[model samples]
Target: MNLPTASRQDGTYPRPQQLRAHWADLTGVWSFRHDDADAGLADGWAHGLPDARDIVVPFPPESSASGIDEPGFHPVVWYARTITRDDLAVAGLGTGRPRVILHFGAVDYGAQVWIDGAFVGRHEGGHTPFSFDVTRHVTGGAAHTLVVRAEDDPFDATQPRGKQDWHETPHEIWYRRTTGIWQTVWLEAVPETHIARLRWTQAGPAAVTATLHLDGHVPAGGSARVSLRFDEVSLDTVEVEIAPPARRVDVTVPIARLRNGQAARELLWSPEHPRLIDATVSLRAHDGAVLDAVSSYLGLRTVAVDRGAFLLNGHPYDVRGVLNQGYWPQSHLAAPSYDTHRREVQLIKDLGFTAARIHQKIEDPRFLYWADRLGLLVWAEAPGAYEFSPTAVQRLMREWMDAVERDVSHPSIVTWVPANESWGVQHIADEPAEQAYARALADVTRALDPSRPVISNDGWEHQNSDILSVHDYEGDGAILARTYADEAARRRLLDRMGPAGRRLLVGGAPDHGQPIMLTEFGGITYQPDTERDDSWGYTEAADGDDWIKRITALYDAIRASSFLAGSCYTQFTDTLQETNGLLTAARVPKMPIEDIRAAVTGRRKQR
Candidate 1:
């Protein structure tokens, strides 16, 4: 059976800076073969795979969208597709001696790319984007063979696998494993000296700072100019001269100057009013001719933590959030379409959630784009490995750094979570090395992007964390109310049994000043399909009305706590057999949306 596909636009991936660059979508069917024996390399399979089966690009073989529909273990897989000269020509790569780059949105575990049977590059880290220049490997008017090898070991604890099931079948909380490509694959044409990266920051209430990284070489006396806009209205234009061997340039634009003495707050961004500003950057030759141009956007906002409260734009903001796993029933990690991202964020907002903790996964940039446009706060999390080893630490650190660098410019992402529930560093509280690693991760995150708060080890272990967060699954509201009635009482409880009774704090003295949040709770399971014996939830609800009552009570308990800044409900949608979600796996509401919204927003009480 075929799974439903998402509505995709022409150019959906590579978000944050949706540049107006020459590009082509390399999705759809491709030749596929399972390298069970791992003999593709010795077999010279990169040259061709004529006997291979057909599968869709960007969707893993385990997914129905790939046309494989086999969820069993496949350690190694190979994909082959032919890129014709027309494909390159359409992307402006056929002439002008432009560089042709092949971009892979994400590949599972490990990936190797070969062009025209020549090894181009290899990349590790399953959930990050990687690219290679294939200009030299392809002829201008001829077809070239593109091949990829993906290797994944789901049982290997050294790699960050998130919730991918290690067993042959789905179990407990883990779901089916994803293998091979699971995101968009595309091609782009760029000048030899092109804009490599664009990083933006709100310098102050009145200005935005943009840092540009250039690749290749720049001729002497070349220059670059940036044009700023707000809602299509011209803001300001800044220019900078570039010398040969130059790579980095910084430019700041003052909004007041663009608004003709208007205050910066006139165009401030908030959840209630998501205002975005567009920017276009152009590189020029000494003769003032435009060599390259790319388009991007930014939202003007600031986030801070002050006195046990999360502040947005200098005002205390309560984070009514849900734990979004970023999983789909059919596509697994990949969204069915770019529109699905917008709809999901809209659903969260419609359900009265102001924020969402993208739990245990580095989500797609398109999803973050919608979050920014729709004004939804996000807690970006790094997927965790199950074991504590040197390899695990290295992999986690590299991928986490990549994730942070890729998402730092997004205004919707207010927080960074490096570890969750002590998944990888389980002995962080007892082992000095683990504690050091966790602290190092937190430090690295802050060093890369200090504007946002970092929850070092969310849901327990309180080492080097900006926010004091805990996860408790107790179903009783009275218990939650009594446990966190006051800061003194909460500290005493932490001293006695530690957070979650696991000794989350090393010295037993909790950080009194940091904001406290119930990061995870209220996993009341409601299995609408009672006939499925395999389905399960964290805690069973007696009925729909009982579920509402229990959920409302938990929200009330959270609101009543003097020390709590906010809370995140267990999850947004169900996945696999874990049916503890406000929305079912198919994105259907299990209960009245208004009732849940009332409970979450604290507008009404259940009699």
Candidate 2:
């Protein structure tokens, strides 16, 4: 099997036509060493050439596959590589225009890019994509040195480092910290005045609007002719004038061009039947000259809360989900490959859950791509910090907006969670700062993507949001607490004072009343002595039958509660040492799969 290089070894980097393969994947053959470079570029001595040190692409330098079979490394790290146009052109650059742009899919926490000594730019967030215009820096078809300096301060609790335990090398809950570039690094060449960014939105009926954001110099006389297609069907073909260097033109594709029931149609996207339509976008001059082209895909689906029920495609659909950690045994934060991500999704679906709560960590876009294609609903959450400072909050929220814009096209995402269990709002004791932070984040998330629901805080504090979402490990404690609160004189006294309980429902009530989802509930860890045994044991090894009984009992308790629309187990697999998972560490079923499936799916023949 052939692998991708920084520049195509054959001198050709694939074109936008091969967008999926567009990235040169400079993951392998890159020289690696531990370096503590300051954020600001400083003059320093470095190796003249990239040594033959190989670190696997998308994996941290400390991993075994990165040619360094070790765990611990200093937070500051550096990566150096050289790219050649001749090598790229052979790979696929294909004698196109000499212009080229370099892209870094993602880097951890912070990174600075340097092209042969001149600093181009720097990015703060670790989980989103960033790019640089290196066309000017390239010495015309010659090889150029590209350097990336990355640092992740594990002790800096102010930043959004989710489940990343600095002190604990690899423990129950925390996984390895992915430093430097943990995503694909690639380069591409395009027309000088080409399309920079494009967005498509469906606006009911046969009206699908396309917006084209152009960059560089636009022809003063000609208009931008926009053309798009879904499979063999041509959805739109229109000509709109580009006002100037940074102006964007909006065009509506005709509904009739969509073809029969397929043309300009809004098809439902769900787990049972994952349907997707591939789209091709092109920019052309008024004289019919094609300037640029790119391909993308989208799913047609909407999620909302209506009349005390979660609705998908205007129908009430019960959301049975599990909390997905987005970590793997083989690669930790970095998945082994695309196939590994697919296998995890398949495991979720096979367990009979339709949705997953992607807790804390901002998952890779490829994972979201699979969710959109496989019909898995997602409640995407941003990594939260334990403490909230103004500058930190501002930076985290800005990064959140960038993440949303990059992933808004995906259909699997149904909600946004800005703060998780620790940020603010103590479940038992809600601090004023925590409450204030939750309220502020809720407002910001809505302003960014009002299309989806925002959970101000997933658990503990109920400062704000579209749904009454909670994470409780009380072990059927809500039931007993409710009973006691209803009977306690203190509750009666508080009720007599005014509508205090009303404030309990975060975000007030939805237009249709706030629906409650026990987003997290049972985390019954059952590890049998034999790997192939069918026993459910909690904590340590309890009676095998007792474990199953307790899980069923918890399900009944949740189902009987009117406040909770549904519940999600703590997790599907036993991740690392925190073996509180329904499934074993290897994703093997611990109990009879059908038994748990019946309880979760509400298919127990009704008493």
Candidate 3:
């Protein structure tokens, strides 16, 4: 049967693992209405919002890609769509009493989902995926009304807003706010007992440890089996007896055995050679009848910080990274298409950068998938809250946990940054409570994924961090070199500058033994076209030659530091008023692409 897929621009789902599965994409035109007074529930709009106009799904109303092209702040927005059983059947789902799950890639702030006017579930946190089982509310060969209500308060300092502008207009570094559904919505069919979550971790370079979490009870005398394969070649098969009330099962596979006496390095995953292993997990009854099956993939790699160096697969790996805000000119926070993400990753690789600090945004899963497939290291960072109140801390911690859980499976993500430059926890250097909070976040991240490094706060005042990072946009390369000439001089300058200077290094003053990186620098402003008064960068350059000269000098300063392991340029593309990007907002190169690549790869000397 020809499966019915979403007519989305990219014609794909955000999660690649779900592509061949029994699922239907619901990301097209939908009835939309703005609720300024939060009166949708009071007025019984969940039954149907017939008067609402049409707006595309998976794109915010503020984004031009949504077809609304309205960039106003709407605290509440309502969306309504009608789906029939045929719609599910066409997508190869909703058959044979299967459990139908409604999934939302993401909805801004808080979301309430209802099917046929019956409230199914509600979810908080704007950037994480959530789902609800709607089988009871949905009937085969019948029409069902699906309504979604999203409430977002841009000005709420208690919420993690990230770079979304809280004001009515874009200001400073923040851009337009994403209001309603900004990601894909879909439906999937699963068995009574299905695989709920899969966690993969590499044990050394030749062994992989996996944990499978089942969503439902296993039948009596049934067992769970998992098969590992690489390039369609079977490696190992393991089976576990069904245990009552135990929802989790652990299995370890030795990949070296599959190599047949070959070198173990062939199975390792890195930027230069990204190798992935596919797996099929199944739950079988006593008669050997397959009750459930799901397909997933994993990459064997390990990341750690060893003796002031970032180690990837137990080897010292220098991180050549760029700052990516995960924004598009048309879609704002939402990517215009899945291909857009793929192209961005390829472009970063072409630009001679091995890694990208996904700045202040939990990126789309598709982007992380491409990063894994194309081999680009990523530093997953959490959106920031401007305030340090208890509510803000609680909100950030909860949302960050969800974010980590959502992207933990992606092998390309080598580092987890809970905070950036102390944006929300501003008083961490002085306030003991804030310091404790930062440390707690780092601890939580390490506990969640012990294989990867966690940067408590990427930039300054790091209470607990696997890597010591700082953001120094010192325009003059000579001064920057002098500032970090030696460990003692760096500490003296940091202490004298104090916390107010934004240069103070808190939490033990960056011992030379820990991994250090200049996470943000070389924000040379270059606008080839007419420069508006609002457009600004860190330091302005006269032309392409001057820009190249300044950037190369900054790179030289970073390369000269014996303690510094890596550096990330200001950004990959121009975002809003910030023009300090290697590429223009339209993805156009400002200077010669090869020249920029040479500067970043350390192939060219400062001249």
Candidate 4:
């Protein structure tokens, strides 16, 4: 995979949207051990684990990259690392009284942190970012022992584990379990009271909004100063006053370039343009002292579903997308490295896909960053719970909100998928409680980020959705073409269609004028090189040429249908036990890149 060197490979600036120059990337080697019997806490392992072996940080022990390729049922894992003053200095920190904030990009299931053996903080939600201010517990300018205990129960069906398998061995769709830290770990230096959360959105075609959530109540004489820049041209800065006790402040800035009416469309963000405007926002006191400042960026765009079309930047867009589960052959879910994200995005685009569904996983932020930078649309979906219960919905809500809060600012994310195939609410086809649960997911995601279109449930049984997307694996292109030949035929098909030919929607909502697309189809399994036990896909192809033929035919079916405005192919890469990806698990293209591109774009493959 001829991937170029990735920036921030050492994990510096893990959170690019809220970047700080004075930060440390604590993501290399760490002492690791597993507590299979769950006796570490009682045995005082927080101070240090006995007989611990070295394991790579940010990659779970279940993965090969972590140097501990043991895929056993160790629910409890422990990790210890030291952060030194020289480490901080190398990260561009100076001798100062700034508060030290420890940031974890993500940890699976549950995480508890201790600084120098003193409990600092604990957080739930495996795929969401969290942090703690360890300044009070740390020794000034000295090395501090940081210990983390992570717990993930494989048999916990109420948890939103995505594709992580519960059984001893991965089978069918489920893969290996990632029990602990699976993303970057870093630290930052900030003021006593600083920006805790920053979000950006398109307020209008001519303006954008920035919302900053403060760590504490607004101090007296508090004001937020914001400056905007487009293509290197800085615009006038704006400042807004915040009253006492107001923890959140929303500031809107009129984009000067977007305000230019006729030429404004040139600055609009799309899969073709992908124009991002740089921004620097600061929290200042009336005395002109900076309390907190953050540098960020936003794209000027609008996404909507209207009259049987998916609109991007207020214009209809052909969503040639592929479902990406965010897995790897080595690292499971943790992107093997940051550069791997760039290569994935480039490969998706190279195959003529304008978007990625980001199926199931919330995805690494760096992947979204590259999508924002490299002109590709994204549908950010949440991991699903396997069972339905009050606990399940509660878990789903907490993590879904965290996922949205962490990823809402990205310009590449144009769609929000709260559920896929109704995994947790499996009985939504009849049960009111299950139906309401599905609706709540959509409502919550829309409530959080109202800018993007929300698909309540992708694949089937959508109660309230801006677009209706169904997953069908019918391989015969001619039958697909005929089923979608007309509006009446499409409606009849949807009324009787699910991924496996079940009911598609509740409340008879198909009459509503909204876009409908084949979100998952054409899983043509073709591994001409390797063999596996019970490897499965929707359809089986003979060889490389047969694979290309089936791919082109499937794409042609979708393109030939006038009403099917958009489509997402079954997947991007071959995951474990699933051999139906345009590229292999190692990210090597299955066929010629150009041939795949031709098929993806509805063009005939050259002889």
Candidate 5:
């Protein structure tokens, strides 16, 4: 489970796929001010905010890491940072590599940025990342001031504000609002025209297709060279001309393993034996000069549904997943640090879970990078919208596409969850418009990435999905075992409303041909040494012994099921008032880590 990253490379610059060795992290202290009145623009705050306080970059103001841990409703906020002349030199930006790209991993809700008081760009969508080129503003080796404004309306139900609570105070299920910047901000130097996007898809066992997207139209006689390697062994080096009007090119690098026969599966990536092939896609000129290049890696793996089972690399693979809301007590939605990301992934694996369904939030790429490198499977789910509407559909479509496009290159991602438990499309059981929206979530995601399965609605009442995922929290192990004893019994359970009071399928039901997976269950609460009425879970356990007994029974029942392809525990760790997790809010396990791992993997020691 402690497998090394594909490249063991430095994960800087926010964008993990298009990585460059030389870059500057703009994540230290920055000038910050709460523009509650929304008058920062008229007051020329962009020029400079004098009475501003120092707040840490990336971490939102609601998070303690930001140095302003006030969780109040601040609809408008601003941040200012100075990129010094030395910073650019250290990042290797200059003539030839004249372009300096300012990248923001993510900004909540809406954002507008300025450099030297010049409006550089504006972008919306809280969970998706965006960037801009500011070389003109940073000319002549001089320092430039970068200012940003972010607006997040807490009460806007149409917003795809995942777990961010609209209420003034966070309540059950929803967490605090993450206003302004909640991810990394950095600077990287690139050629005038660089490989803006890179994607690797294993269309067949023998060949891997690479698609490179250019930021700008390539010069007439430009060519792109793609080199592939596995375990330090070269596979192939293919070059294609970047002809005009075509900003995209797909180069198929024939993998040697396929031609070797029988050894073709050697490079297939799985949780146990995660093997990654290293690659470097370089932008070359007509004269064969390398204009720009990026280092990346991909796993030759495929995930799909094959006749009532989830297949990985064309074989049935059960996805033993755990729910991860991606929340840190100190950092909230923002990851505490990169090491924290690694630890979280490692901890989940230590519990014997192979995959994690990132509950609502779209996690940062660094986390996904580690998941890809460390061999933990991921189900990338979009944040839920409380209510459905025209605006909500539009917002989700745009942002979900952005989220999918950004993380599609990661081989660790095996599923795309666009909607979950009908949070947005609540009336999809009958409503045509809502059903259409749910169907579109699946269709559009497939159009973007057909390599993985799409769980349009994850929990129950699934509109369009590859697997029949249900959530049942029946604490009584005996009754739960009886409910899904076999295929017929499981079908009867789905014929009625699910534990969450939603139909198993809407606008017509599952034909029962897909694999069944219990996505959520066993939220057993156990608060050892501390007791509070406000804190609760779906079911309560008396003590550490009781928690272990109850969790073991739950896993035993799941393992006994005859129709389950896999199952996911309620959650990986506790968050705030939610006391139902294998680990506590601070990540302290309630029982022995080994015991939890035993129950999770059904690897109980002999009595």
Candidate 6:
């Protein structure tokens, strides 16, 4: 069944009353309809065009919950809404302040935003958030019109489009395209002289530092007071002198307050414990006046790859994780609510998996936030298509830089995987360029966030990487780990199949002490409805009981192998056309949850 749709201009997701305490999701009915090809919304013709047609906010027009469930034809989807300065005032915007910031959670492909009658800004990336300062556009208490025009070519090869196959009916590997704004749009007020941005890091138990960049001017005070709260309790409060351009503000909180060291034991956030601590930060003037306050949260957890074993909290830990694409049956690329997003993460955790490799797509910031709080480890990956251009790679690198800059603060993100299996690199005959791009991304990612490990390319050629990775789906579980019958048998197998067969035999879990991860494997598709077909992992109608046995045996072999560190199962949920998933498309549990948990956690079944 489809999710409920909201019908008000000022309503949030689900309803206005159940707003998430931490966020304000401006998702509801808005004025939207098809525009003429001659007169477009971008050319300021949308000023007073009285088209009160209904369109759901936050859901792409093509989605089932969008109220308009028709397929978008790659045409420009135009949206216009008449919002007053007072609208911003209710959201703590334009409240006697000369500066206001309007933030869009995400927009597909390219978008142009016009506030009132003037153009504000345009952004390119379809998966990341962007904002525009629209204070000057507001004229007194009068009404202002905001218009956004978005265009998306879902099959654009060079762009980082993941699993979005336009022009094709529902297929095996790809699903529907989500265009226009699929996330929230909200405005917040900030003082004329205020802290514009902050990049911070936690060095140790007691110390944390941030480099603040003020937008226009710092407040008229030499000292700025900073306060950090953890769930209503102040964790750290300190006063520091403001540097003109910028200065690093360092604060030391008690070990109990920071909870950095205690996390290893008492308060460590883990799937088993799932402890979360809130942090609300506020910048203040020397006179004890609060300047700006934004709610934030942090988890204290560390992941390391050492001695050919993955370690969490300084102990050898095996990661039974899944490769989650983060797509929904109805919402497609977007989750209907923060609760919906949180439910997915909780499902991963509930399945006895400690981590998840978010495959092929840069997820919404909320996913990372939920992972951090819910104690689910994440391996953030960049979307890789079958083609790549140098110019496109450069832009991708820039977006990756921004993604890292924005996501580095979260403890749940343990690794950065820049490419998946060298899909596009193969097209380039010059091996040097391909290797250079791979190495360059590794270098840039490491330079950007040295704390996390970076996997160069998931599988394919394996050019250069901090960790040796493979995507193996060899024979069934029994044959994959079994010793090759002989050199002739191995050669015959290699000759019959392609490079994939060769990699399975030759790679054999790298002998080097460096970490070895089965980044992709075990995509057993179990479609009970189609029982004639027996390939349970990748095909429908496979033997349900046999599927479980094979997967469990595969996990057993990998867990016993000394060379392998961890394995991420093919997927968590069955995405649209790809039915190889542990759970059904709607995220309903397929097999017994206890059985899957037993296989993953290595827990001995009770007698």
Task: Return the top candidate by lDDT.
Answer: 5
Candidate 4: RMSD to truth: 3.3
Q: What lDDT tens digits, residue by residue, belong to model 3 across residues 285-382?
A: 88888777766677777888998799997789999999999988788889887678889999999889999999988888888878888899999999
TM-scores, all candidates, are 0.95, 0.84, 0.94, 0.96, 0.97, 0.86
**How accurate locally is residue 185 in candidate 4, as Cα lDDT from 0 to 100?**
91
Question: Candidate 3 or 6, higher TM-score?
Answer: 3
Q: How accurate is candidate 4 locally (lDDT)?
A: 0.84
Tens-digit lDDT string for candidate 1 (1-607):
1111111222265554646445777888999999888898999998888589999877888988778988998999999999987788766674443788888888998999998898999999999888898888875547889999999986798889888989998988888888989888888888888888888887766778888889888888888888787766788888889877879888887776534435656566777887777787878888987777777878888888988899988889999999999888788888877688889999999899999999878888888888888889999998889999988999999999998888888889999999998898877778888888888999999999989999888888778888888888888989888877897867765666654677546634356588989989988898766545677766778888889888988988999998888889998998888889999988988887888898789888467
Tens-place lDDT digits, model 4, residues 369-401: 888888899989989999999999999899999
**Highest-TM-score candidate:** 5
Instruction: Rank the candidate models, highest TM-score first.
Output: 5, 4, 1, 3, 6, 2
**Residue 58, candidate 2: how far off, in angstroms?**
1.3
Better-scoring candidate (lDDT), 3 or 5: 5
Q: How many clashes show up in model 4?
A: 0
* TM-score for predicted model 5 compared with the true structure: 0.97
The residue-level lDDT of candidate 4 at 11 comes to 28
The 0-to-1 C-alpha lDDT of every candidate, in the order given, reads: 0.83, 0.64, 0.82, 0.84, 0.85, 0.66
Candidate 2 achieves a global lDDT of 0.64
> Which residue window of length 10 is worst by lDDT in model 3?
1-10
Candidate 6 TM-score, C-alpha based? 0.86
Superior by lDDT: candidate 2 or candidate 4? 4
Error of 3 at 592 (Å): 2.2
In Å, residue 235's CA in model 3 sits off its true spot by 1.8
